[model samples]
Target: MSNPTVSRIELWHFGAPLPEPFWPSWIPGYPMTENRCTMIRIVDSDGVEGWSAGPELIRERRGLGDVVGLMLGQDATDIDLAQQRLREVGYFGWKNWWIEPAFWDMAGHRAGQPVWRLLGATEGGEVEAYASFGEVRSGSQRIADAEARYEEGFRTVKIRVHEDEDADIRQVTEVAAAVGDKLRIGVDANQAWRVSAFADAPQWDLDRAKRFADVCADIGIAWLEEPLPMDAYDDQAALNEYSRIPISGAELHTGGEPELRMMIERGCYSIYQPDAIFTGGIDQTRRIIAYCKEKGVTYTPHTWTNGVGFAVNLQLYTLSDRDKPLEFPLEQPSWIPECRDAMITEPFIARDGKVQIPEGPGLGVTVSQEALAQYGEQFFVADA
Candidate 1:
């Protein structure tokens, strides 16, 4: 009758190879050939396994076992305790928020309800999906891609733009013309977490962001995301006030509720996109969602990490009262659903540009043992 306690934990470093190299606009010039993540499986005393994953470029979490040991034997359904434990782990300079969802998964299984329901959703249903392109491609290619997405029934599409101001404006203009009124467009500057290690990445100032926002408004952009750095609260607030279109960001912001609350108070953005994995997990993200609702700000999560990350956010997105479509990370050949979700039994494929909510309990994620054996290496295991 008591809550199930954590009994065992296992971790794997998975690298699912892509069919082709993926050029992510955020981390310019880096050729990502694998969908890499640190996969965690937590089994409660009741023998129900909960799963979660964190994005990784390497086995950097080799020492995570020592940290995760903090949760062994704790109440699996006590998310507050789990969150506190994760925060303690962070004090050691490690952001392990991504692992907190595994506890929610366990609680859902124990209660015989999906995670979304556990989080207060009245019912389960499909959510509209926007095709989120990961690369900044040529104008012609981007137009073709938008056309293809329209054919696939995606009424909304988000495109990436980086570097040169003129080139970025041109790309958005061309794609807008190609799709016209057929698809609503969102533009991501990828300026929140700028990566210039491999190649030069442009850093946007207030002047540039204002100019871009004007252009986006003229071209009918639905939103402009991350126009300034994540911490630029003052500038972001000014830009949000100055722009005609909505401004959104905070996807990977690690400052948790306090930081997000400050942004909300400052009117930093009209829309807040906090990915559960990066933004202090589900519990904290839910708090942010409530704040956004109270402050009249739009709340839609960023779900570009991977299948498991997507599943975690999907469960949380169902809690939102807004009708915005979820961000469906879909770049061609390299970052398609097959490769993105290779570790899970089912890939989230959008049909008519909408993905049905998973009905199963515990995050609705079923890890594929076969795929795990093929694409993952077991690196850590512990028992209570």
Candidate 2:
């Protein structure tokens, strides 16, 4: 058996222009873009590599130099320690959440199994994907595009309602009028975490969120995600109570354990979508899933960051037996896996609009280092 040692921790940034700009219909004030993924890599003692990534804003970690060394030579096999180290570094404004998948990779390698198998998940099950649009567009355009999306294997879709109260009303009205019964729609407030780097991203007020919730309910929408900021526990709880459909939040909360514990107590989400990367790490995500299961809240890990980020969280998503659908962020030309995951070989092929559980070893993801060499810009590489 391999004694799983942490020989190297590497971070790579690889981005490609999107085929076209995609401004989500919901993020009212954001601009569309073609910029794509920035990846993460981790190699264990045995020379095995595992990869993950975040989108668009690449090279954010050019200065990870002063930090990654803390993980050098540690037992990658000891996931608890790795998770702790990652969480501890987060206190100083640097988020090492993307590195959490490294521990799962090491854990799987040491145990001679795929991470999913080790987590007790069954392979080859199809997970339904919702068409999560990234471009901001009008209600008529949304109706036409969503109609096209239905033919493209998506039974459900998520659109951004970017602070246009009346426009939001029109969009929902069109959706219910056009295909509300045929397709289930979920609106993403995306207010859980704001991306202010871009100048046009619209911010949502609490009143707008509540009003939107009323519209969502009136339209027979399936669920509403992140209507308020992720930490606004009281507001989230209150909205969840009155919202006709399910209420959900918690994507970029790096405070992790404590924040999730508080949300669980306050019943902040009917469905808690914690991104494994943005959270503490794999073990901490495992804890979140356990809590959700115990509390009867649906457990669907968020996967919108990038391809590898999707792959890492998919393993965690399979661990829960909620029998609920998972979020497989696929919206045509702009955010499909082909472009969102262009660097990877088998970029999660969704069949008839659903993805199957992976059976391969590690996180069931393999990155072509040669491809990384071609497109990836190595920002941080630590080996001892």
Candidate 3:
């Protein structure tokens, strides 16, 4: 059969209001009121539709017409050409790597297979998950939350820390004591991609990371994530060597394969977490996963964006041989499964702390037209 040609493209500014205000630890004092993203839909000549999304703080992609023009007549299954087109767009302005997944989604649908199977997975099944908390709360409240997660069948949980040295150490110590050995705990410093746009965020130096690592080691913490800046290659390598526990980061690196390869060669982190949407889409991320296997580095992806972002990464995660649990972004009252996956026909809710891999064609989740009518605003549409 001939390759499917792109026949139409559409873009929408999608936003789902949160039930309550959510103060993300990465941004310090900013109150996030909605889950916002730019959604894209690509329809081929055969009428098979593929979808993808990118996180957005505002409607900054109103000028995406030029990018859409480049994809108008190209073969939707020719991902190499798709990557080249996206890279060409990056040369002039924003890194639009997030949009590349739509090609994979399109190809998977045409082949009548899941994205993971298209990427070479033998079978489709469920994968373990760790409850990833987004905010820093009092130690007492965190302990209660941890216990609740444990009850829900999550064997592991990741907490946030953004205070002074003493307070940070105390927070982990208290939670570790509360859970004992029943739960494995991980701590995210959120320093790799720090956001100071709305308020002052804490910055971590080598000394501070070392001190925190020492406490985490004593408390048997599973891993410490993004303890230093994303570009601090030399410091990250040094800290990884110094720390008794495993060090992990690299989400939203935006440098693609070459930069990630350099870090792997430098022994930057024991574990490498690259979200496919933010890194360089599925193809580049697959290369990163193979490189991690060759270098003996752990490869688990970051899945904190919206439902589409999570689906994109979940497909990539199945290609890895590593057994690390996928990051399941869950925070109560605000970033729940329903709101995060408002557009998806079936929300990816974790049962017993494990999410069943979607078995449908393409990215495996169906986009809800009704929900789109409710939450998405169509901003651009074009036909070849």
Best by lDDT: 1
CA lDDT for candidate 1: 0.92
Q: What pairs collide in candidate 1?
A: none
Summarize candidate 1's per-residue lDDT along 275-314 as a digit string, tens digits: 9998999999999999999998899999999999999999
In candidate 1, stretches whose alpha carbon ends up further than 4 angstroms from where it belongs are none
Candidate 2 lDDT trough over 10 residues, lowest sum? 25-34
Q: Rate the local accuracy (lDDT) of all candidates.
A: 0.92, 0.74, 0.90
Which scores better on lDDT, 1 or 3?
A: 1
Each prediction's TM-score versus the true structure: 0.98, 0.92, 0.98
Instruction: Encode model 3's per-residue lDDT on 158-203: one tens digit a residue.
Output: 9999877788888899999989589999999999988888878889
Clashes of each: 0, 16, 0
Model 3 misses residue 9 by how many Å? 0.9
Query: What value of lDDT does candidate 3 attain over all alpha carbons?
Result: 0.90
**Residue 254's C-alpha lDDT in candidate 2?**
82
Model 3 ranges off by over 4 Å: none
| Clash count, candidate 1 | 0
